[model samples]
Target: MVKVSFSSALAQKEVKKDAESLLPGEKDPEVGVPLRQPSRAWCWCMCLGLALMLSGVVVGGAYLYRYYIVEEGRVFVCGVKYREEDYIIREEEEVQLPSHFQLRKLEESIRILEREQVALINVPVPEFQDSDPADIVHDFHRRLTAYLDLSLNKCYVIPLNTSVVMLPTDLVQLLDNIRMGTYLPQSYLIHEEMVVTEQLQHVEQLGYFIHSLCQGKDTYRLQRRDRILGMQKREALNCHKIRHFESNVVVETLICEP
Candidate 1:
């Protein structure tokens, strides 16, 4: 009986030990969660890394767009100087004076009559000035007459008076004037008339005509016309003339009728 009792006690002890092992004690502090499950800390780190990579991509794209686009095709104006000999044709006149004196007049003319013509249209003429107005005017008339005598017939000349011209004080008042409003069309018509009358042969003759017009009193009209047109367009037409430096040529540009 003693042997049987000892054996029974030993079996009971083994069962108790097996139950304790299966139930598992308070969970291990070090391995509280399963190793297969992702940790919240690791998930947050992954999200932060993805966010950084995305931001980098966006920033790089913006930089490339700015560098490759939006900075081309700009117009710049530069000034150049030319000499008298560059003109296609030049003429001289001799004047006989008292006491066996003689004066040689240099007449510089462009080759508007040639087949290769350069066109000048509606160029603004600057105002002229005279320290002694009467003497200058007389001299202008004499030179003009002499020019007309040549009968070149390839250009029309409009003389300007520099000494008497001024910019308009009130822009509105200036616009009301008929002379300034129709200057361009009138000039165009004048050119056309000259062409029709056989006074100007080639379109290029217009350049010479513009140069001549800019020489004296008529430039004021051109400038006034340009200013009026600029105001109407809401742009500054302050630069009234366009010049081709190599050719000693000037023309009208940037003025548009409203």
Candidate 2:
């Protein structure tokens, strides 16, 4: 509802001039061509242009998101200046590990094993009279089994002398008892106790069996074949004697792939 105004002087002047021009009775020249309805094609072209512009914006935004925003972290890392001694791994190489290194590693390994052996041997008798001494035996059996299994399967070579062996069925069953966290039948347990006074003797035999497998070899090398060497955590004493153990039995064995 805006009111448009024309200049008063210009309007008056134009009216006077027109009046003077029209006195001769000459018809006024045609003012202008009348406009017709716009063609449908023009409307279609405008819509098409708008659609194209919208599509271009969407595509550009996606490109910016992926290569600029998403990849910004990797780009920043690549642009960083690094020191020469930063251990940038560009290529793979096989470096022969030194004998001294092997010695040091084995010494550390043996120290840990010895500590574990001592811990197993000196298991404090449970304060409760109902507790079983055979639990100590179970714990030792598990460790020895791990050691044997590593020697048998994993090539975890140590500086200590060892002998390779194909384990007998009886020994295998005993090892399984440790893995399954199971006990032998009462008759079998009684028979074994009668045969050997100390469960520690069984451990010694297992160790001897493992030692014999080394065939007097002084040095052995372990090449990692698997992505993981496996994990090592001691199992808590199994009082439940549940046949179906809740989790996968984790055994810490000498470095050998079984």
Candidate 3:
């Protein structure tokens, strides 16, 4: 009888334990420990990895931006010793020539056209070992153009009527492609011979661009032999030449003085 009573009490205790577990406040001991929340250090580590990846992406993007601008020639920066304003030309002149002096068309790749009474000449930067890459640019019909000397950090300007030309559409596209390293055109070499008919006495009257060019040198006004021969005969003159290159054209300007 005692054994039966003890068994009945043990079964009752088991039933009570199961009922306690079924209640919301109690957990069954057999279910094992509840899962723990992530540690603070682990969460921080994950955040750091994500932050590093984001920073890497930003840095890579910046590097690519700089590379394209430089390689594509969108931004041209000169040396620290150079100033931008010193090379600017504020003065310009326009001299009318007689219609009899006709400029011959050089070739298919080059054309000398007059737009709004301005003469478009195919002139380029004088070649020098120290000379940096430069570009010529102007707004069409602006009558003013600039020769940007990247090495010297100079922007020389001349009036269109004075044999300076604005950037043509074809040449502009070609230069862009060259800068981007996409295409290269065959370069043509040409020469222009000019005789110095008159020494420049009034340097002040000359444009700032030309004045800068003639600085420290005896400069003279140049004229073609064909034009001078038609007008009058002249003696042989002392001569010097400047070799220049731009885009696909190389020009040798021979300047002579009596």
Best by TM-score: 3
Off by over 4 Å in 1: 1-34, 72-258
Better of 1 and 2 by lDDT: 2
Candidate 2 wrong stretches, greater than 4 Å? 1-32, 74-99, 102-258
- How do the residues 1-258 of candidate 3 rate in per-residue lDDT, one tens digit apiece? 455335888899999988887899676668887789999999999999999999999999887864443223222111111111212222363434345543321211122222322222323333334223444433345544334344444344433323423245544454446554432333334555666566556554554334444354554555665566653345566555443433344444445556
Predicted structure with the largest lDDT when compared to the true one: 3
TM-score versus the correct structure, for each prediction: 0.19, 0.21, 0.35
Q: For residues 160-194, could you state the per-residue lDDT of candidate 1 as single tens digits?
A: 32232112222112323423332211110000001
Whole-model Cα lDDT per candidate? 0.28, 0.29, 0.44
Ranking by lDDT: 3, 2, 1
lDDT by residue for model 2 (46-101), tens: 99999999999999999897545542321000011111121222236443433443
Q: After superposition, how far is residue 251 of candidate 2 from its true place, in Å?
A: 21
Query: How many steric overlaps does candidate 1 have?
Result: 11
